[model samples]
Target: MAAGIMLFEQKGFSETSIQDIVDMLGVTKGTFYYYFKSKEELLMDIHLRYIEALLENQKRIIEDSTKTIKEKVFEIVYMLIHNIEKQGRQARIFFREMKHLNEDHLKKIVEKRDLFRYNLQLLIEEGMRNGEFRDDLPPSIATLTVLGAANWSYQWFQPDGKLSDFEVAKHMVSILLEGIEKK
Candidate 1:
């Protein structure tokens, strides 16, 4: 799986061959075929693991009773940014290679992805109901905006840069909750 991820990240899912992955791991075709029936299956496994981890972390963050909705939102965004930095290749694979999955595989992944989105939206709805966030905007749109802002960062986020994921997440949350123009 590690070999497949590296090859997919380096050469993209469609371009990467099973032989390339097996060679990277110093294994033979029989060894690779023994575990996974097809290359797409390996990519699917990587995608499943990546998103499932995010969903699990998200559930934990959302379930913390002590944290307010605002805090929960911050943590959710922070978690995503942190995960992207920690698992850059996996994140890249999840975002970029999703369309390559077969219909059945894609459907399963989309379900999990929707569940993740729904959970975030639920948190935003809760905040609105509690008068924590502005009630003027639709919760769905707000949730999408928050997620889109954070998810889009993976394209350019640098883990080894001067700033940490924590710092970037905070800045992003601030811009999200507060406008860029002077208050």
Candidate 2:
């Protein structure tokens, strides 16, 4: 699956073939076929795994009741950043290779992605209710801003770069909640 995902990202899904994956894996076609009926199945598996991991992490962040809504939001952003750092390749594949999934698979993945967004929206709503966030702003919009900033971090963020994931998360939280300029 790892090899398949790498190949899919390095090349496009349409461009990548089962033969390419098997050749990269240095295994027989039979070995690849034994695990996945087709390349599409393997890509779907990768997507499922990536989304499940993300949801699991987000759920945990929300479930930790000791933290205030603001803190939880910060943690959620941090968690997402950390995930990219920890699973950069898979994250790339998750976003880039999603288009290759058939309608049924795409629908399922979209559902999970929406679920993740919904959870973030709930967090934003909670913040509004608790007076930690501005109620004037739409919860959905704020949630999208936060999620978009974190989700899109994969484009330029390097796990081994100068700035740590935590640093990026902190900056993001500040940007989302407080904006720029000195108080």
Candidate 3:
């Protein structure tokens, strides 16, 4: 899986071959076949593991009672940005190569993805109810805006950049909650 991820991240899904994965690991073709039916299956497993981890983390943050909804939002954004360093390849592959997945695989992934989005929208609705976020923004749109901004960070996030993930997350949360207009 590690080899597959690295190769996928470096060379992309369509470009990387099963032989390349086995070559990286010094393993036989049969060894790779033993665990995965094909490269697409391996990619599916990798994507599933990544999204599952994210959902679990997101749910955990949502369940924490001590933090305000705003704080939870910060944490969720922070988690996504922070994961760039922790799970860079998995994320890049998940976002970049999703179109390659077959119908069955895509459907399953889409279901999980939609569930994540719905939960996020619910969180925004919760914020609106609690007056932590503006009620007039429409929870669904607000949720999509927040998620789109945060999730798009995968395209540009850098572990070695001037700002750390924490700094980026804080800045994003500020703009998201407070807006660019000066007081």
Candidate 4:
């Protein structure tokens, strides 16, 4: 799968072939077939693994009673940014190659993605209810805005760049919460 992710990241899903993956790993096509019936199935596995791990981590963040809603928001953003550092190729492939997935696979992945967004939206709504975040903005929009900013980081963020993922996350969360207008 690592080979597939690397090749997919470099050559794209449609461009990548089962032969490419097997050749990269120095394995037979039979080995690949043993695990995945098709290349798309492998892609589906990647998508499931990525989103499921995120949901699991998010469950932990949401369940932690010690953190404030605002703190939870920061943690969630940080988590997304941090993932770029850990699984940068997977992140890139996830966003870039999703269009290749079949209808049923796409539907399953979209459901998981939407669940992640809905979970964050619920948290934002909780913050608004508790006076942590302003109630003026719609929670759905706020959730999408946060996700857009963090998810888009994969496009430009460098793991070895000047700014660490933590710092980027902090700045991003600050900007989202505080805005750029003068005080």
Candidate 5:
């Protein structure tokens, strides 16, 4: 599965063949088939694992009673960056190769993605209720602003870069909660 994910990340998903995975693992076709019915199934497994992990982490952050909503939001962003640093390869494959999954698989992935969005929105709503965030702005817009900035970090953020994940999260939180342009 790791080998398949690596291949999918390096090479485009459409370019990767089931034979490539079996050959890379030095296993027989029967062995590969025993584990995964098809390459699509393998990709789905990767997506499922990634989403489940992220959801678990988010749940932990949300359920932490000690933290303020502001703190929880920052923690969520930091967790995202931290997880990406820990699983850079899998994250790459999970995000980039998702398009290769068929319609049914894509639908399920979309549902998971929506769950993430909904969580973000809930955080925004909580912040608004608590007067920690700008209540004038719609919750959806704030949620998208926060989520978009955090999610797009995967495109440019380098784990080994000068700034740590928490640092990046701080920057994002500043821009998101504090706004970019001066008051």
Candidate 6:
């Protein structure tokens, strides 16, 4: 699966063959087949692993009673950016190669993705209700804005760059909360 993620990121999903993956891992075709009936199935597995880890992390963040809603929002954004740093190739393949999945697999992935987004939306709505966030903006739009900013970091965020993942996430959360306008 690591080989598949690397190859898919480099050569694209359509260009990556089962043979290429097996060759990279120095494994037999039978080994690949034993785990996944098709390359699409392998892709599906990768998608499931990525999103499920996220959902689980998010569950922990939301359920933590010690944190304020603002803190939870920052932690969620940081979690996403940190995951991108740790699993850069898999994250790339997840966002870029999802179209290769079949209808049923695509539906499953979309449902999980929506659930994540919806959960974040609910969090933002909670903040509004509790007076942590302003009630003027729609929670759904606020959720998307936060997601869009964090999700796009995979394109350019470098773990070795000046800002650590936590710093970047902090800056991002600050911008979202404070905006760029002059005080």
- The estimated TM-scores of all candidates read 0.97, 0.95, 0.97, 0.98, 0.94, 0.98
| Cα shift from native, residue 140, model 6 (Å) | 0.8
Query: How far does residue 145 in candidate 6 sit from its true spot (Å)?
Result: 0.3
Worst-scoring 10-residue span by lDDT in model 2? 4-13
Which stretch of 10 consecutive residues in model 3 shows the poorest summed lDDT? 131-140
TM-score of 3: 0.97
lDDT of 3 by residue, 53-152 (tens): 9899999999999999999999999999998778988999999999988899999999999999898899989989988888888788898888888899
Q: What TM-score does candidate 4 reach?
A: 0.98
lDDT of 3: 0.92
Report lDDT (Cα) of residue 115, candidate 5.
98
Across 1-183, the per-residue lDDT of candidate 1 in tens digits comes to 999988899999989999898888888999998999999999899989999999999999999999999899999999999999999999999999999999999999999999999999999999989988999998889999999999998998999898999999999999988869996
Model 4 clash tally, residue pairs: 0
In candidate 2, list every pair of residues with a backbone clash: none
How badly does each model clash, as a count of residue pairs?
0, 0, 0, 0, 0, 0
Model-by-model lDDT, in order? 0.93, 0.89, 0.92, 0.95, 0.87, 0.96
Q: Candidate 2 lDDT, tens digit per residue, 97-129?
A: 788899999999999999999998998898899
Query: Candidate 2: deviation at residue 110, Å?
Result: 0.2
Best by lDDT: 6
User: What is the C-alpha local distance difference test score of candidate 1?
Assistant: 0.93
What tens-digit string does per-residue lDDT give for candidate 4 at 1-183? 889999999999988999999999999999999999999999999999999999999999999999999899999999999998999999998998899899999999999999999999999999999999999998899999999999999999999999999999999999999997889
Evaluated against the true structure, the overall lDDT of model 4 is: 0.95
Deviating ranges (above 4 Å) for candidate 2: none
Instruction: Using lDDT as the measure, name the better of candidate 4 and candidate 5.
Output: 4
lDDT of 5 by residue, 26-132 (tens): 98889989998898999999999999899988999999999999999999888888888888878888778888888999999889988988997898798889888
**Distance from true position, residue 179, model 5, in Å?**
2.2
Error of 4 at 16 (Å): 1.1
